[model samples]
Target: MNIALSNTSDKPIYQQLFERISAQILKGELENGYCLPPIRQAAQELSISVITVKKAWEELERCGLIHTITGKGCFVAELSSDRKLQIRDEMISKQMLLDTSYYKSFGLTLDDVIAMLKKVY
Candidate 1:
Protein backbone atom coordinates (compact mmCIF):
# COMPACT_ATOMS: atom_id res chain seq x y z
CA MET A 1 0.00 0.00 0.00
CA ASN A 2 3.06 2.24 0.29
CA ILE A 3 4.90 3.40 -2.83
CA ALA A 4 7.35 6.06 -3.95
CA LEU A 5 7.56 6.61 -7.70
CA SER A 6 10.70 7.87 -9.38
CA ASN A 7 10.15 10.05 -12.43
CA THR A 8 13.76 9.75 -13.53
CA SER A 9 13.89 5.97 -13.37
CA ASP A 10 14.43 4.12 -16.63
CA LYS A 11 11.37 2.02 -15.88
CA PRO A 12 7.84 3.10 -16.70
CA ILE A 13 5.54 4.38 -13.97
CA TYR A 14 3.21 1.42 -14.23
CA GLN A 15 6.12 -1.04 -14.02
CA GLN A 16 7.48 0.73 -10.93
CA LEU A 17 4.07 0.49 -9.28
CA PHE A 18 3.70 -3.17 -10.17
CA GLU A 19 7.18 -4.08 -8.86
CA ARG A 20 6.72 -2.24 -5.55
CA ILE A 21 3.31 -3.72 -4.88
CA SER A 22 4.31 -7.23 -5.84
CA ALA A 23 7.45 -7.10 -3.67
CA GLN A 24 5.38 -5.96 -0.71
CA ILE A 25 2.86 -8.72 -1.21
CA LEU A 26 5.51 -11.40 -1.62
CA LYS A 27 7.38 -10.14 1.45
CA GLY A 28 4.18 -10.31 3.51
CA GLU A 29 4.19 -6.58 4.08
CA LEU A 30 0.74 -6.67 2.56
CA GLU A 31 -1.19 -9.50 4.16
CA ASN A 32 -3.36 -11.95 2.29
CA GLY A 33 -6.72 -10.52 1.21
CA TYR A 34 -5.58 -6.97 1.91
CA CYS A 35 -7.61 -4.65 -0.26
CA LEU A 36 -5.73 -2.43 -2.66
CA PRO A 37 -6.96 1.05 -3.40
CA PRO A 38 -9.16 1.36 -6.44
CA ILE A 39 -7.36 2.17 -9.62
CA ARG A 40 -8.82 5.63 -9.97
CA GLN A 41 -8.16 6.46 -6.34
CA ALA A 42 -4.59 5.23 -6.55
CA ALA A 43 -4.01 7.19 -9.73
CA GLN A 44 -5.32 10.35 -8.08
CA GLU A 45 -3.24 9.81 -4.96
CA LEU A 46 -0.03 9.04 -6.87
CA SER A 47 -0.65 11.79 -9.43
CA ILE A 48 -0.34 9.29 -12.20
CA SER A 49 -2.70 8.39 -15.03
CA VAL A 50 -5.62 6.07 -14.26
CA ILE A 51 -4.55 3.88 -17.14
CA THR A 52 -1.14 3.43 -15.52
CA VAL A 53 -2.63 2.23 -12.25
CA LYS A 54 -5.00 -0.04 -14.12
CA LYS A 55 -2.16 -1.59 -16.07
CA ALA A 56 -0.17 -2.22 -12.88
CA TRP A 57 -3.17 -3.85 -11.24
CA GLU A 58 -3.69 -5.99 -14.29
CA GLU A 59 -0.06 -7.09 -14.13
CA LEU A 60 -0.45 -8.04 -10.47
CA GLU A 61 -3.46 -10.18 -11.26
CA ARG A 62 -1.68 -11.71 -14.22
CA CYS A 63 1.22 -12.71 -11.99
CA GLY A 64 -1.23 -14.28 -9.48
CA LEU A 65 -0.16 -11.80 -6.82
CA ILE A 66 -3.63 -10.27 -6.55
CA HIS A 67 -7.16 -10.95 -7.62
CA THR A 68 -10.10 -8.67 -8.35
CA ILE A 69 -13.75 -9.15 -7.52
CA THR A 70 -16.50 -7.25 -9.20
CA GLY A 71 -17.43 -4.23 -6.99
CA LYS A 72 -15.14 -5.46 -4.22
CA GLY A 73 -11.77 -4.26 -5.51
CA CYS A 74 -8.40 -6.02 -5.81
CA PHE A 75 -6.92 -8.00 -2.94
CA VAL A 76 -3.56 -9.67 -2.37
CA ALA A 77 -3.54 -13.40 -2.96
CA GLU A 78 -2.87 -15.83 -0.14
CA LEU A 79 0.66 -17.16 -0.50
CA SER A 80 2.52 -19.55 1.76
CA SER A 81 6.12 -18.86 2.70
CA ASP A 82 7.43 -21.47 0.25
CA ARG A 83 5.32 -20.04 -2.53
CA LYS A 84 6.60 -16.56 -1.79
CA LEU A 85 10.19 -17.75 -1.92
CA GLN A 86 9.53 -19.57 -5.17
CA ILE A 87 7.98 -16.50 -6.74
CA ARG A 88 10.80 -14.32 -5.49
CA ASP A 89 13.41 -16.65 -6.97
CA GLU A 90 11.53 -16.90 -10.23
CA MET A 91 11.29 -13.13 -10.57
CA ILE A 92 14.94 -12.62 -9.63
CA SER A 93 16.08 -15.29 -12.05
CA LYS A 94 14.19 -13.67 -14.91
CA GLN A 95 15.68 -10.28 -14.17
CA MET A 96 19.13 -11.78 -13.80
CA LEU A 97 18.85 -13.35 -17.23
CA LEU A 98 18.32 -9.93 -18.74
CA ASP A 99 21.08 -8.38 -16.66
CA THR A 100 23.51 -11.11 -17.59
CA SER A 101 22.77 -10.59 -21.22
CA TYR A 102 23.40 -6.88 -20.87
CA TYR A 103 26.67 -7.48 -19.08
CA LYS A 104 27.77 -10.05 -21.60
CA SER A 105 27.24 -7.53 -24.35
CA PHE A 106 29.74 -5.30 -22.57
CA GLY A 107 32.20 -8.22 -22.28
CA LEU A 108 31.91 -8.32 -18.49
CA THR A 109 32.41 -11.67 -16.78
CA LEU A 110 30.31 -12.98 -13.93
CA ASP A 111 32.98 -12.07 -11.40
CA ASP A 112 33.19 -8.56 -12.79
CA VAL A 113 29.43 -8.16 -12.56
CA ILE A 114 29.41 -9.56 -9.03
CA ALA A 115 32.08 -7.11 -7.96
CA MET A 116 30.15 -4.21 -9.43
CA LEU A 117 26.93 -5.43 -7.82
CA LYS A 118 28.67 -5.73 -4.46
CA LYS A 119 29.78 -2.12 -4.63
CA VAL A 120 26.31 -0.83 -5.41
CA TYR A 121 24.44 -3.27 -3.22
Candidate 2:
Protein backbone atom coordinates (compact mmCIF):
# COMPACT_ATOMS: atom_id res chain seq x y z
CA MET A 1 0.00 0.00 0.00
CA ASN A 2 1.19 3.56 -0.80
CA ILE A 3 0.29 6.45 1.46
CA ALA A 4 1.38 10.03 2.18
CA LEU A 5 0.29 11.52 5.47
CA SER A 6 -0.07 15.25 6.09
CA ASN A 7 0.19 16.41 9.65
CA THR A 8 -0.97 19.90 8.69
CA SER A 9 -4.21 18.89 6.99
CA ASP A 10 -7.51 19.56 8.68
CA LYS A 11 -8.41 15.88 8.35
CA PRO A 12 -7.22 13.47 10.97
CA ILE A 13 -4.45 11.02 10.04
CA TYR A 14 -6.74 8.00 10.16
CA GLN A 15 -9.28 9.65 7.85
CA GLN A 16 -6.57 10.52 5.33
CA LEU A 17 -5.31 6.94 5.45
CA PHE A 18 -8.79 5.54 4.96
CA GLU A 19 -9.59 7.82 2.01
CA ARG A 20 -6.35 7.23 0.11
CA ILE A 21 -6.36 3.45 0.56
CA SER A 22 -10.03 3.13 -0.29
CA ALA A 23 -9.53 5.17 -3.45
CA GLN A 24 -6.63 2.96 -4.46
CA ILE A 25 -8.66 -0.20 -3.90
CA LEU A 26 -11.66 1.17 -5.81
CA LYS A 27 -9.50 2.29 -8.72
CA GLY A 28 -7.99 -1.18 -9.16
CA GLU A 29 -4.56 0.17 -8.38
CA LEU A 30 -4.58 -2.22 -5.50
CA GLU A 31 -5.90 -5.46 -6.95
CA ASN A 32 -8.54 -7.61 -5.35
CA GLY A 33 -7.17 -9.99 -2.72
CA TYR A 34 -4.02 -7.88 -2.30
CA CYS A 35 -2.88 -8.30 1.24
CA LEU A 36 -2.34 -5.07 3.17
CA PRO A 37 0.51 -4.81 5.60
CA PRO A 38 -0.31 -5.45 9.21
CA ILE A 39 -1.44 -2.47 11.27
CA ARG A 40 1.71 -2.08 13.29
CA GLN A 41 3.90 -2.28 10.22
CA ALA A 42 1.80 0.23 8.37
CA ALA A 43 1.81 2.61 11.31
CA GLN A 44 5.54 2.28 11.70
CA GLU A 45 6.15 2.90 8.04
CA LEU A 46 3.78 5.86 7.96
CA SER A 47 5.22 7.28 11.18
CA ILE A 48 1.80 7.33 12.81
CA SER A 49 0.17 5.60 15.72
CA VAL A 50 -0.83 1.95 15.44
CA ILE A 51 -4.29 2.84 16.71
CA THR A 52 -4.75 5.24 13.79
CA VAL A 53 -3.90 2.60 11.20
CA LYS A 54 -6.16 0.12 12.94
CA LYS A 55 -9.01 2.63 12.88
CA ALA A 56 -8.51 3.23 9.16
CA TRP A 57 -8.40 -0.50 8.45
CA GLU A 58 -11.58 -0.99 10.41
CA GLU A 59 -13.30 1.74 8.41
CA LEU A 60 -12.19 0.11 5.14
CA GLU A 61 -13.69 -3.19 6.31
CA ARG A 62 -16.81 -1.37 7.42
CA CYS A 63 -17.20 0.03 3.91
CA GLY A 64 -16.71 -3.44 2.40
CA LEU A 65 -13.58 -2.32 0.58
CA ILE A 66 -11.50 -4.88 2.50
CA HIS A 67 -11.84 -7.99 4.60
CA THR A 68 -9.74 -9.39 7.43
CA ILE A 69 -8.69 -12.98 7.97
CA THR A 70 -7.57 -14.24 11.32
CA GLY A 71 -3.73 -14.23 11.44
CA LYS A 72 -3.60 -13.47 7.73
CA GLY A 73 -3.92 -9.69 7.83
CA CYS A 74 -6.37 -7.63 5.74
CA PHE A 75 -6.97 -8.15 2.05
CA VAL A 76 -8.70 -6.02 -0.50
CA ALA A 77 -12.24 -7.28 -1.11
CA GLU A 78 -13.19 -8.79 -4.44
CA LEU A 79 -15.72 -6.51 -6.07
CA SER A 80 -17.41 -6.47 -9.45
CA SER A 81 -16.71 -3.49 -11.69
CA ASP A 82 -20.27 -2.26 -11.24
CA ARG A 83 -19.94 -2.58 -7.48
CA LYS A 84 -16.70 -0.59 -7.54
CA LEU A 85 -18.38 2.20 -9.47
CA GLN A 86 -21.30 2.13 -7.05
CA ILE A 87 -19.04 2.39 -4.02
CA ARG A 88 -17.02 5.16 -5.63
CA ASP A 89 -20.15 7.15 -6.41
CA GLU A 90 -21.48 6.64 -2.90
CA MET A 91 -18.26 7.90 -1.35
CA ILE A 92 -18.07 10.89 -3.69
CA SER A 93 -21.71 11.77 -3.05
CA LYS A 94 -21.18 11.81 0.68
CA GLN A 95 -18.19 14.13 0.32
CA MET A 96 -20.09 16.31 -2.14
CA LEU A 97 -22.90 16.72 0.36
CA LEU A 98 -20.44 18.05 2.88
CA ASP A 99 -18.68 20.22 0.29
CA THR A 100 -21.98 21.62 -0.94
CA SER A 101 -22.96 22.55 2.59
CA TYR A 102 -19.64 24.35 3.03
CA TYR A 103 -20.05 26.14 -0.26
CA LYS A 104 -23.57 27.19 0.57
CA SER A 105 -22.40 28.56 3.88
CA PHE A 106 -20.00 30.74 1.88
CA GLY A 107 -22.94 31.85 -0.37
CA LEU A 108 -21.51 30.09 -3.40
CA THR A 109 -23.95 28.77 -5.97
CA LEU A 110 -23.63 25.53 -7.88
CA ASP A 111 -22.25 27.37 -10.87
CA ASP A 112 -19.70 29.15 -8.71
CA VAL A 113 -18.62 25.87 -7.20
CA ILE A 114 -18.43 24.18 -10.59
CA ALA A 115 -16.39 27.03 -11.98
CA MET A 116 -13.98 26.84 -9.08
CA LEU A 117 -13.77 23.08 -9.35
CA LYS A 118 -13.04 23.32 -13.03
CA LYS A 119 -10.13 25.63 -12.35
CA VAL A 120 -8.70 23.46 -9.58
CA TYR A 121 -9.49 20.10 -11.13
User: lDDT tens string, model 1, 1-121?
Assistant: 7899999999999999999999999889999999999999999999999999999999999988999999999999988889889988998898899889999999999899999999999
Q: Report lDDT (CA) for all predictions.
A: 0.93, 0.95
Model 2 lDDT tens row, 1-121: 6788899999999999999999999999999999999999998889999999999999999999999999999999999999999999999999999989999999998999999999999
TM-score on alpha carbons, each prediction: 0.90, 0.93
Error of 1 at 1 (Å): 2.1
**Model 2 spans with C-alpha error above 4 angstroms:** none
Screening candidate 1 with a backbone cut-off below 3 angstroms (N, C-alpha, C), the clashing residue pairs are none
Error of 2 at 67 (Å): 0.6
Residue 108, candidate 1: C-alpha displacement in angstroms:
1.7
Candidate 1, superposed: residue stretches over 4 Å from native: none
Candidate 1 worst ten-residue window by lDDT? 78-87
